[model samples]
Structure formats: structure tokens, C-alpha cells
Target chain A: MNASEEYEIMIGNHAAAYACKGAKVQVVAAYPITPQSPVVEKISYFIESGELNARMVRVESEQSALVACVAASATGVRTYTATSSHGLMLMYEILCWAAGNRLPIVMNIATRAVGAPWSVWTDHQDAFTVRDTGWLQMFCEDNQEIYDTNLQAFRIAEDPCVYVPTLVSYDGYILSHTFMPVRLEPQSRIDDFIPPLKHHLNLGDMNVVKGVCPVTTPHVVKREEGTAPGYYEFRYSLQRAMEHSIEKVVEVHDLFAEKFGRSYGNGIYKAYKMEDADIVIFAVGSVASESRLVIDKLRAKGIKIGLISLKLFRPFPAKHLREVFKDIKTVVVFDRDVGYGYEGILFTELKSALYQLKNRPFIKGYIVGLGGRDVKADDLINGVLRTIELEKKNEYVEQTEFIGLKLDELDFLKKGGKVENGR
Target chain B: MTEEKDYQKILASVQKPVEGEAGKTGSWSTIKPKINLDKCIVAKMEKNVCHFCWLYCPEPIITRTIPPRILYDYCKGCGICVEVCPHKAIEMVEESEL
Candidate 1:
């Protein structure tokens, strides 16, 4: 077999681990959480067997794990870490700090439902909650995309125009634990693709330590000199870096496709069979894989249906989404988590993105799979079909609906009614 | 050894201030610390004390004395001595006024 030939694999976690190793990540900071534990475990074994020369730092908390990586990256080392759900939440405050200070660290997040009833199941809520934390967020559709996108994430995040952290998320328990065929890129090729990191600003150097603040003073003149262009200047520069990442993401994706044989689609949004469809479904994560199968089945029966899988969520890709959904009459958004008082968070953002456009689709937000509940292809098909039906009747539901809810055990409550189970 | 000699030469060049501005004259208009004998705690008591102003100036702007005074031309107005002086003997008077 040729070196370019694909080597199929069975699990997303294994594929992610292989990609990290293939990228020659120098340091691995591992803290175990459900569904994300296997990613670090596989890397640890590889390190012990001398397959990789990575240092695995066993940290006490997710915060310290990220801090350790930040410290290591500041020294101009390639760093990698993985976390899920509560662990991702714990690393929230430092996530902004890392990006603000311009550290290039790559992290893998296994998308799990945040707790109330406590579940280790699949959902995008955990990653979505930190969407505004200044990290480049990418959702993977399958095992191959999971493996290849992780490599691309490093290149994109570390690029000079976009020196921010990145998080590649795969659905917990669904794509993460499930086995699938994934092609591996040669280690040498990946090494050539991602060069060793060169940091522009590193701490502890004599110039940096002495030049940062020569002397501490409480004088107004000295204070103004020290903090000129002040706090807002720092935050504004970070925002500009994130906005600039939109172009860098496409450039790196194209470069990676040229070097390797695989391609992660273009234009920020990937449309499947949406050319002439009157109704389209917008979703992300492993659920998009299921939506694809449903779209294929619906298309065979002569129904005009399609699906738009959101790949990059943080930059939101609003302009690209508007162009894609321009002609469609209705769009049904399947969200894996609820925003409590509002509809699905993605649905709210999508609506706000399309609000000012003269020609826009009527969007319906559906909250599904709250506690790792499985969202089958049939469930998605039914939701899209109902959305089409509502459009045909010229009737729309202003309130969001929870699909696939088991209502046998719970009683319905009115606006002014006391629940029987209440204390 | 060669590098050390080069650095010392650079340091020696900076040590000599421009001529015609020598000793309590010329730009002796530049405020040099003036010790007040009456109000100074150490100068009045004739003791080796009151070095707070000397120790606190960020730029080494305060000249060490029984009660220290400031060299204003080089002082960047950090006001460390003004805040640190226990007897409030030091004031950051304007360089132009001095």
C-alpha cells in the first residue's frame, strides 16, 4: 500500500490521540473526566512505550492543568490538553487569560451534557457555554474529521494573525466512544505540516522581565506611562485577533487539504442536499451525521429537504449562514441544550444573525437530548417535517418545543396550578 | 574579558555630565537636595537617622543626608519619598521653581 492510503480506525478518542501524537505534541497535561479520559490514557501509553516524546503532567485540577500548559506554551513548547463538561467549566476564567496573553494551546473537549440530573451522555451544551471565551471552537462530524480537524486546529490557533487557544469537540458517548473507520496521516507528513512553535513574547527573559516594568511607582505620570492604552486596549486587541481568525481558519484548512488527502468543507457552513430545498435543518456535532442519513432518505422519496452542519460556532459565521439560507423558506434548528429562559442558544444566535436581512427564513428552535438522550434520525426527520407543515399552514410556534420527551410520569402544569409532587 | 572592557568604556562615557555644569553652579539651578539643619530630625538631634526619603525615591533622586533633599532634574516625580517620609520633611517641589 502507498503511504498516502487511508488506515481506517474505530473510535473518535483513538483517532484524536493518534492525531495528537502525529502532530508531535511535546507536552500532554492529563486530568481524567468521563468520555474524555480515553484520549489522555492512549497518549500516556504511547509515551511509556516510547512512541512519542511527550511529558504527561498529572495535575490536581483542570484549572492547573490548563495553567501548566499555558506556562509550558509561554516557554515556546507545543502543548495539548483534554477535558469535558464540568472540567471545561472549571477552566473558563483562565481560557480568556490564555488567549488574551496570546498563548497557542490546543484542547480536546468531549461534548457532554452539563449537570442537573447528572449524565455522562452526549450534548454540545458544555462547549457552547464557553462560546464567548475567545477560543476557536470547532465541532466534528465523524471520527476522521475529529482526527484531521484536531491537527488543523493547532495550525489555525497558533498562526500569528490568530494567536488564540482552540477546542475541537466530538459528541460524548456517541462519536467519542463509538467505533468508526478513520484514516491516519503519516507522522512525518504531519510534522512537516505543523512546524515547531515560535513565540514572539516569552516570560523570564532578561529583556522581558526588565522591560515590562522597570520600577514600581504610585505617581500619576508613571502609572499613566505603565498602563497607557489601558485595559480596553488589551481587550480590543484580543477581539480583533479573534475576528482575524475567520480568514486564517480557511487558509489553514486549504493548506492542510493540499498537504494531506482529506478536506474539511469550505465556506464556514457545510450544506448537504440543500440546493432547491424549501425546508432546511440546521444542527451541529454528531447529530449532523444522523441528519445526513435522514436527508438522504427524504431526498429519495422526492421531498425537498436538506441539512446545514455548523463547523465553527465561536466566530458564529453569520454572513456565511445568511448566504446559505437566503432562498429557503424555513429552517429548523436542533439544539442539544436549553438556555433556560430563552430558546436553544444556537437558535437565538442564528436568529440574531439573520434578523436584519430582508429575505430570511422563518426559524424554529427545537431543544433535544438534554441529559445525553439519544436523538435518532427519525426524531430529526419528524422535527423537520413538522416545521415544513407549520410553514404550509402559515402557522408558527413562537415557543420552543422539547422533542422526544417522555411525558408519562410527569403531569402537565398550567400558568396557575400547584404541582402534586411539590413539598 | 574584551566585552567587559567595552561595557566599562560605555559606563565611563555616561558618568561624566556635560562640562560648564559643574558643582552647585551652572545648572546647579537643578534642584540638589538641601539639608535643613533646624527642622531635620537627624540634623537637629545630631544622630544617624532619618534616611526614609533617601531609601524610597525610585530613581535614586534623593541625596542621602541627615534629612534628605531631592535632585529634581533627574527625578521623574514618583513621589515615593513624599509618601514615605515620617517627618514630612520632603516635598516634590517643581523643578522650574527650584
Candidate 2:
């Protein structure tokens, strides 16, 4: 441990706030939501106490919060905000706007389940809902990872090769409310790690009057004066930025490890005990962290199993997943959220990623812990055992099944032991 | 890396401040607003006085000066200046009449 490093017991929300403070974010625009409020609240306190010289703009709603961050980030300043399920839903329009404009605004998502049954619990639905919005998404396993990922998010988002906004998400109550010891590097080292943001567009400059995200033709418009790229070209460039960010993610992770002595795999996903395993358990966030215990238990029983905890979700990291899962025989995905009409979102996406493989593994997905339900190690073990049994019996396994559900007790739907769920 | 550097040079949609972003709306119209210097308030006063046509012009093509002139490049023939000119100095004249 470095002499300049300080270890303190803090919740994931406070860790995110300290990350924002350490990065010296210039503007914080946010509105309050459960599980995400403490992050912005602590940032506001930092601003109030003059520990961080930054502007705190408390807007009416999450939409305006992101909008203000977009405008502030366009001015070449590092900006931040926090939101949850409904709040993220409110900011969906501006989320695309931020990405389309290539603004490097960082936001922490305390991942919560979207409501219809009015659930205020931890889930992946909130993060998965806008997976195609073109933002770089990272999921954290614990408070320490929450802190490290948040700091790394700023550098990754503002990298010249990738001027895309970033979302650092941790499970709502699991990480946000739970306290853990996080090692924080000194302010000078942090400053050296993440310098002031030098964004592409600076709307704050008065000398240069500029128009941003204006409507353009579907194809390039050429005239006697000059040539202007069309909307398609702009979108292609954004996609390229997303693709190129994978390298920057690894580069920044290595640099951070060199300076702060903390690393998470190659910054895309972290693997545990995959050297000789034929079957791998795939999960994200707290569920993946919890599965480490399950791995230990299963390993003791002479099972050839491992765990692949995904850190980066967006841009899918298809290449890396494909590389890691090439020799594997089976992959069992545990999701805290379902894709509603389809199976688990990660399960479908992982299948899509491995579609091109010549000898693909048999993959099964199980939905577990929706709406803050307690995800027990026994349940995870049972899920893994069920998958292994299906493999041994040579039976076609179901695509998605709910884990730890009290289906027998429920009187709503019981027709021959099969409930007609989603598509 | 060189390829990446090349992509970084020309990013997504950001345009410098330019006039006629929608491209010279004057060409879209058959008529344009014409101002008579003889009756214009600013023109007659010979000093920077009331230029209602310049203030109310939606396209804001009218110049704020002595004998205020309408910039025909992007006028769009809106006739807002004609209705706004208190002294009846502005009129939307057809191109054939001009």
C-alpha cells in the first residue's frame, strides 16, 4: 500500500461521490432518486464545504439533470450526475443526445428495477433497458470497484479516441447502502491520473459561435464551398468511437493499476478460475461477486466450473467474450433481471456474441433476484447443478427459468406445472 | 493508431457559426420585402431612431442603420417587416414587379 493512500469504510454511493471529487468534476447536475440520491447528495456536500470547487445545479428532474450535464460537458468541463430506474427513463432522450453529440459526461446509475408493480429494488433492467443508447456502461461488484470504476469511467469517456458519455452502474441497495473499506489514492495521484477534461466541442467559448447536433441530410451534402457529412456518417463515427473505446478501457486500466495498484482483468471483464474449466458461470454486478462463493463451493465438490464477472456491458465486448469462451463447453448465465418478452438480456446478448463460433458451447440462462429478492448461494448452486444435469442427460435445456420463485405457493397461474410467462 | 487519429480529426455533428444555415430562404419565395428610404423613421430622422422593421423582422434581414437596408440574401418574403413598419415604408413587392 502506498503511504499516500487512505482506506476508509464507505458505502458505494459515497465512493462514487469521492471519485467525482477526486476527478475534480467541474459541474454536477442531478435530481434525487432512491439509491442514487446519496451520490449526488455527497457531491453537493463536497461542493458546499469547498473541498471540491464545482458548480452544483439541482434541476427539476433527471431529464434536465442530463441536459445540464450535456451543456456543461460541451463546454470542455468534466460533468457528472446520478439517477436510477425511473430517473434514467426520464433522461433517455438526452442520453442519446449526449452520445450523438459525443460529450464525455459521467453518470453513476444505482441500478434499480423499473416499476409497474412498483418495485424499488436492485436489478439490471434499468441498465439493460437503454443498452443501445451508445453510452459506455460498466457494472461494479462492490464499493471498492464502484470507486475505481467511477474514476476510470471519466478517463475512458474523455479519451480523445472515445468522446462518449459513460455510465458506472452498481446494484441499487446491494452496493449503494452497504459499506466496505475502499482504498482512495491521494488527491495528487488522482489529479495525475485524471487530468482536466479536454473535450471535442466547447460551446462555452464565446469567440466561436457554433451549432451542435443540428439536423442534417441522410447523405453527405456537397457544394461549391465545401462538403458536409450527413447524418449517417455522424452515426458511423459514434459507432467507431464505441468500438475504439475497448482499447482505451484496457489502456486506462493498466495505467491505473500502475499508479494506484488496483486492476480488474483487462478492464472489460474479470475471470475467476477459468484456466481448466469446461463450464463457466456468467453474471454481472453483485450477483457475479456472490457467485465467487458458489464457485468455491462447486470446486470443492470436484466440479470443473469457473466464473466470468462482466464489468463492461456496452459495446458488448463480443470479441473478448468470444476469445474467453472459445474452448468452454457450457455457459450458465444468472441474471437479476429479465428481458420481459425474451429471456435474460445478458443471455441473449452473449448468445449473439458467440453466434459466429464454429464449435459453440451450450448456454443456459436463469433469471434470479428480481426486485431485490435475496439471491442465496444455495439457489445459485442448484441452478448450476440443474444446468450440469441437463448436460449430462443430453436434454435440451430451457432458455430462461426463474430461480428461487415460489411458484407452487402462488394461486394465480397453475396449469399442469407450466406457467405461461413471457415470450 | 494513425487510423484512429484520422477519425478523431472529423468527429460527429458540430458546425461553425454560419449565416443561412437553412440555405438562403430568399430563394424559396417569389416576393421580397422592400423598404422606402424616403418614409423610413431611421432614414428620415438621419440618426439611429425607431427601426421597427428591423426589430420585428422575423428573419432579421433588415440592417439597423441610416436608411436601413433589407438584406435580400435570406429575406424569405415573410412580409412581417411590411406589417411592422409603422410609417408604411416597407412593402412585399413581387419579383416580377421589381
Question: Which ranges in model 2 have alpha carbons more than 4 Å from their true place?
Answer: A1-5, A209-214, A223-225, A411-423, B1-6, B16-98
What is the lDDT for A142 in model 2? Answer: 88
lDDT of 1 at A136: 83
Task: Give DockQ for candidates 1 onward, in order.
Answer: 0.03, 0.27
What's the alpha carbon RMSD for model 2?
Answer: 5.3
Per-residue C-alpha lDDT of model 1 across residues A1-423, encoded as one tens digit per residue: 963456675688888999899888888886899999999999999999999998999999999889888887776788899999989889988887777666778999988888866888888889989988878889998888989899998888777667788889999878888898888877788889887776655663534432222322232122322332334545566677777678778888888888886676682667888778987888898777788999998898888988899988877788778888778888889999888788898899899989867988878889888778778878888888888788788787878798888765455455555588643
Reference-based lDDT, residue A152, model 1: 91
Report the lDDT tens digits of candidate 2 across residue range A1-423.
654356899999999999999999999999999989999899999999999999999799999999999888888889999999999999999999999888889999999999987988999999999899989999999898989998999999998999889999999989999988998878998989997777788776756644432347787766655677787877888888899889999999999989888999889999999999999999999899999999999999999899999999987899999999999998999998888888999999999999989989988899999989889999999999998888787687555689989867754466655444532
Q: Write the per-residue lDDT of candidate 2 for residues B1-98, one digit (tens) a residue.
A: 46555456556566653457678877889998877888887877899888888788766677788889877878788788888778998888888776
Tens-place lDDT per residue, model 1, B1-98, is 22322111111000112222223332433333443446568767766787777766655656676545556556555667667767765554545555
Q: Local error of candidate 1 at A422, Å?
A: 9.2
By how many angstroms RMSD does model 1 differ from the true structure? 11.6
